[model samples]
Target: MKDVQKVLDWVVAEVGVPGIVAEVKDGGRSWFGTAGVADLETGAPRQQGECLHTGSSGKAFTAATILALEAEGRLSLDDTVEQWLPGALNVNGYDGNTITIRHLLSNTSGLFSTGLAPEVAQRYATRAGFRRHRFDAYTLQDMLKLAVSQPPVGAPGERFTYANGGFHLAGAIIEAVTGNSYADEVETRVIQPLGLADTYVRPAADISYPDPHPKAYSKMFFKDGTDLATLTAENWESLLEDPGLAPMDVTEVNSSGAWSAGNIISTTSDMIRLVDALAAGTLLPPAQHRHMWTTVSTEGGYWMPHARYGLGLFEFDKQATGGTPLRGVAGSLWGSWFFAIGTADGRHTMAVHTNTEWKSWDVLFKLIHAAFGLTIGA
Candidate 1:
C-alpha cells in the first residue's frame, strides 16, 4: 500500500498535473485516493464527483444508446444508414444503403475524419457567436449535410478508420428512429437509468462548469518547431456554437461532428459506475452483453483484444503491475483521462481520473505492476 501511495505521489509531483482521483475495489475492499488540484488557477483540490471530458470514451455511451433502443425494438443492429436518413450520401458511386449500424458501431464505416478539412476549423472558431443564439437548435440534418459532402475514404466496412462521422450518423439514426433528440435519448436510455447524474452530452460550446475544472492544453508541431504546447481554454463553447473556431475549414459540421463519437462528458466515479454496471450485466441482458464484448478485426491485423465494441462499451484488458489481470475502457482528451479497471471475476476494480493531460497510463500501468509485485512494463 505504501508503494502504491508512493507511485501516486510521484505521478502528481512529476507530471505537473492539476489533479488525479483513483479508486481500487477488490473482494469487497476498496481504496480511493486523490492527488493534485481540480483547478490549478484557483488552487481547488480534485474530488470524486468532478466531471471531465471523456473524448472517444463517449463512444461507449452512444453504442449503449443504440442497444437500449434495440432492446426496446425501436431499431435493429443490422439497420442500414440510408434506411433511416435517406439522401444522407452525396458521395459519387456511394449509397447510404451500404452503411449499417454495425459498421458505424464497429468503426468499420468509411467516413473520413471530419476534423481533417480546413473549412471545418474556421467555422468552429466563431463558436461564441452561435452560442449567443440558440445552440441546441442545430439538428441532425445539419450534421448529415457535412457527412454527405465527404467522399468515402474506403468501401463501407472495408476497414477500421476511427471516423467520428460514422458515430454522428449513428446518433442521427437514433434520433430519427426514436423521435427524440440524441442527447435526450441518451439521457433516457443510459444516463437516467444508470443514475449517472454527472454524465451528459454537453454541447461543444457550453463552457460553464459547476465546479473547478482543469485547463486543457494541446501540443502542435509546425514546420519550424516541436513540442509547442498551446492551451485550449473552455473554447468548446465557441467551437460548438460557431464553426469559425474549428481548425478545419468546414463550418456546418460542428456539434453533429461529435455526435455519438466524442460528445459525452463524465466524472471518474460515474465512469466507474457505468463500466462496473456494464461488466456486471446490470444494463443489457446476458446475450446482448456478451455481444458487446465481441472484438472486430482491424485493417492493420493487430487485434484490439483489450478493446472490443459492444452495444455501447469498449471492453479492455490490462496486465497490472502485480501481474493481476485488469480490464477497463479508458477515455482521454486534451488534458483529462478517465478509466476503470478490474479483474474478470469482478474481484478488483479501479477507477482513475486526471485533470492534467499528462500520460497517466504509464503511471497507472506502473502502479498496477507494483500492486501485483511485477516489474515495471512487465
Candidate 2:
C-alpha cells in the first residue's frame, strides 16, 4: 500500500487540493503527513499539530455529553425537547414538544437546518459573499431564527434532515440538564479524560483558529442560472473538473453561523483520539454506547453518499453491498473538509482533511481509501 505522505503529496500536486493533512493509527503506531500551503499569502506549508475547525465533527462530543448525562440518570433520549426547551422550536409547522432528544441526535427532528439555508449558506459559499462577511458575528438566536422561518423536513422520526438548529437545541438541553456550559461538560467528560489538550468548543464570538494552522480556501460557482440550494454533488463535481472560477481565501471566518452545531477546533491527532475512544466504548457505558452506535440511514445523497447518522458521529459506506465502513464524523466549514474514521472495534483510526472549501465528499473518500487501503466508489 502507498504510504500516507506519498499519497498526501500526490493529492496536493495531482488532485489540486490545497493544504492537506492526514494521519492513520493502528496498534499504537501512527503515520502523519502534510501537503500544500498553510497561508497562501505567506506561502507557508500545511503541517501536523496545527488546529482546524472540526465543524459538525464536534457534534459527536455534544452527543457524547448528552449520553453521559443519560448514563447518570439525568435525562432520557425519549424525553421531549419541549420538556427542556419550550419556545425554541417555533419553526414553521413544527412543534418542539413532539421532538425527542434522540430525534435531534439522529437528525430525525425534521427541523430546518439553517447551516444550509440560502440566507446563511450564501454568506460563506462564494468568494464575493465570503469576503463580505468573513468576520461577521452570528448569534445562536440569530441562526435559530432562520431555522424557525423554514419548514420542517418531516414529522419527528419520519424524516432525516441534518440541522444545525437541532444540535444547538441539543446544547441548550445540555445546559438545562447539567447547569454548566456545554463547553464545560465536554471539557470535563471528554477532553480532560482523554488528555486532548488541543480540542475546544469555540464560543460564537471567537474568530481565530489555533497556531500554525493552514489558511482554508474555498470555491464557489454554478452553471449560470442553477439554483444554489439545489446544486448537488454531481454538479459540484462538474464545477471542480471544469473550473472557470476563482477559489476564495477563507482562513479567518468566524464559526458563529455554526455555533455549537459545528464550531469545535482540534488537530487530526486529537481527532483520532476522540474517535478511538468513542468507537471503543470508552466514552460511554455499554448501554449508552450501544445507543450511540444505533445509526439510521440518511437516505439521501445530498452531502454524503450512502450516509448514516449515529448519536453524534456519522459514517458512510461507499458500496451498495456491505463495504468497508468509513466510520467517524466529518466536518465542512469555511475551507476545511475533514473526516476522522475508525472501525467498529475502535482501533485502526484514520483522519484526513483538505484545507479547501467546497471540495467534493470524494476528497474524503479517496483519503480514507489511501489511509486504510479500502476501495471507494466513484
Candidate 3:
C-alpha cells in the first residue's frame, strides 16, 4: 500500500499533474489514496469517492452490455452494421454490410477514429477551439459523418486501428435492437446489475461532473496532429515549462462526441469493481465471456504499448508489466486519464485517475507495476 502511495505522489511531484486518486483491492482488503490539489484555484485536495472521467474505459461497459444482449439472444456478435442501421455507412467508401459488431468492438472495423478528422481537430484539439467549443454538443451521427469523411484505414478486419467512431455504431445498434438509448441499456444491464452506484454516462448537454471531483486540465495544443507518441522527455519538460502554453481547465468539455466510447464518468472504487467483474467471468456467461477475451495484436506506439486489444478490453504483454500478465483498459481525452486492471481471477485490482491527460500512459505502467508488488522500473 505504501508503495502505491509513493507512485501516486510521484505522479504529482514529477509529472506535474494537478491531482491523482487511486484504489487497490487485494482479496477482501482495499486501499484508496490521493495526492496534490483537486482544484488548483481553491487548493482543494481530491477526495476518495470523487467522480472522474472514465474516457474509453467506458467502452468495456459498452461492450459488456452488448454481450449481455447477445447472451439473451437479442443480437449476435456477427450481425452486420447495415442490418441494424441501413445507410449509416454508405458514404465515403464505407460499406456497413461488411463490418460486424465484433469488428466494431475489436477495433478491426478499419474506420478512422473521429478524433483524427480535421474538423474535430479544429474544434477541440487547438487551444482556441477548445476554449470556444468545450461546451458544444454533438450527436452520434455528427461524429460518424466526420469519421467516414476521412479515408478508411483498411478493409474490415484488416488490422488493429483504434477507432472511436466504431463505438458510435455500437451505440446506434444497441438502440436499434433494444429500442432504448445505449446509456439506458448499459445502465440497466451492466451498471445497476453490478451495483455500481457511482458510474454513469454523461448526457450530451451536460458538461459537469458530480461534486467532490478534481478540476481536469489539458495543454490543448494538438491542432497540428502532434501525436503524444512522438513526444520525448525533453519535449514534455519544455512543453510543461513553456510560459505561453499554460494548462487549460478542461473539466467541462462536452463529451457527446465520444459517447459510448469515452463519456462514462466513475469513481476509482467503482472503476475497480467494474473491471473486477469484467475480468472475473462473473459479468458474462461462459460463451460470451470467451468472446470478450478473444484478442488481436495491437500496433505499438498507439493506445497502450505491448498490449493485445480484445472486445473493448486489452491485455498487456508480460514484457510491458515486468512479467506480470495484466488485462485492463486505459482511457484518455483532453482533461482526464484513467486506468483499471485486475488479475485474471479479478481478486486483485488497481484503478488510477489523474486530473490531466499528458504523459499518463508512462505513469500508468509504473503505477500498475508498483501496485502489483513489482519494482517501479521492473
Candidate 4:
C-alpha cells in the first residue's frame, strides 16, 4: 500500500498548510492518516480521527434530512417557502409562491446571500474584523433579515448563484414542518441511523468542537478582487503574510454565521460513511438521489471551471467519468475545508479536510488522484 501518511505530509508541506487528516474507506476496510501540526506553538501533530468543520460540505447532510422528510410525506420539494415561513418572501421582494423547496436546495432560487453581505463577509474575511467579532453571537433571524433586505443575485428559477441564505431558509422550513431543531432532525434522521458517533450539527452561536481537533486557521483578507481564479501570486503572498495580526485562529468563530447551512463539526470517518451512502443512494430513495444531481450550469468558471450547481451538490468538469458526478462534495468556510468522494461502483470512499484555509486546490486534486487512482481534474 502507498504510504498515504507520507503523501499527506508532502501535500501539507507543498501547500504551506498547517495540518490535514484524511480517511480512506472501501467496504469494511478503512485507513486513517494525518500530517503536519495541529497547533503551531505546541507542535501537536494532526490526528487522523479529529473533528474538522465540514462547511458547505454539510449541505449534503442538510439535503438528506429534507429528502428523508419528503420520503416520509411530511413535505414535498414543490412546497413553497411561504408555506413554512410566511413573511420570509418579503425579503428583497422575493415571491415565495414561485420559490419551491427544491429551488432552495438546487441553488436556483437566486436569493441574496448573507455571506456576501459586507458586514458578514468582513467579520471573517479581514484580520481586524476577525479579531473583533470572531466569537460574537448572531441569530438565524439575523441572517434571514440580511438576506431579505438586500437585492438578490438573480430572479427565482433563474441562473445559479451560490447563496447561503438558501440553505438557511431550507433549515427554517425543516424546523417549521417538523417542529424540531434542524440539528436534531439531522441527528435523528442521518447520524443516529448510521451510528456516526463523531458527526454533529453545531448549535447556533456555539463555536466549540469536541476533543481531538486541529486549531482552525484562516487567511485574513481585507478585500478580494472580482475574480478568485485571477488572484495573482502576489495576492496569495500578501494574504499569507502576517496581517496586523497573524493568521486568525478561527476555530471558535461564531457558528451561527453558517448555521444549518454549513455549521457541522465532523470527522473524515463519519463523512466517508455519509458520502458513500449519498453516492450509493442509501441516504435518499434511489429516485430522489438523481434529483440532487439535476445540475444547471453555474457559469462560474472563473471560480471553479465547468462548475455546475445541483440541489446542494456540485459538479465540476474535472471529476471522474467526465461528468458522472455522483462522486462527492467539497466545501470551505472561513478557515476549514473538507471533502468526500465515493467510487462509481460505491465500493470505495475517500474523505479529507484541512485545518488550514485555502491554498490547497492542487493538493486536493492530487489527494483524490492518489486515493482513487483516477485522474480527476481537481
lDDT of 4: 0.74
Q: Tell me the deviation in Å of residue 329 in model 4.
A: 2.1
Model 1 lDDT per residue over 1-378, tens place: 566667767777885554677776666676677777665556677665666776677887888888877777888878888899887764655578888888888777777655443334433233232234323334566566665555676787687656667778888888899888888988988899899988899775664444534444322112222111221222322223222222211112233346577767777667767777677767777666665666554435222333444444544433313344344566554456666665555556667766643353567666655554544334
RMSD of 3: 3.4
**Off by more than 4 A, model 3:** 223-244, 319-323, 374-378
Q: Among these predicted structures, which one has the highest lDDT?
A: 3
Please tell me which predicted candidate would have the highest TM-score against the true structure.
3
lDDT of 2 by residue, 149-237 (tens): 77776888886777877888888899999899888998998889888989888877787776867777776434444456764334544
Error of 1 at 285 (Å): 1.5
Candidate 3 CA-lDDT value: 0.82
TM-score rank order = 3, 2, 4, 1
TM-score, each model? 0.75, 0.90, 0.92, 0.89
Against the reference, the lDDT scores of all candidates come to 0.61, 0.77, 0.82, 0.74
Model 1 stretches with alpha carbons more than 4 Å out:
1-4, 90-93, 120-142, 146-150, 203-205, 215-257, 298-312, 317-327, 345-347, 358-361, 367-378
* TM-score of predicted structure 1: 0.75
Score residue 354 of candidate 2 by CA lDDT: 82
Q: Write the per-residue lDDT of candidate 3 for residues 278-300, one digit (tens) a residue.
A: 88788899999999999988873
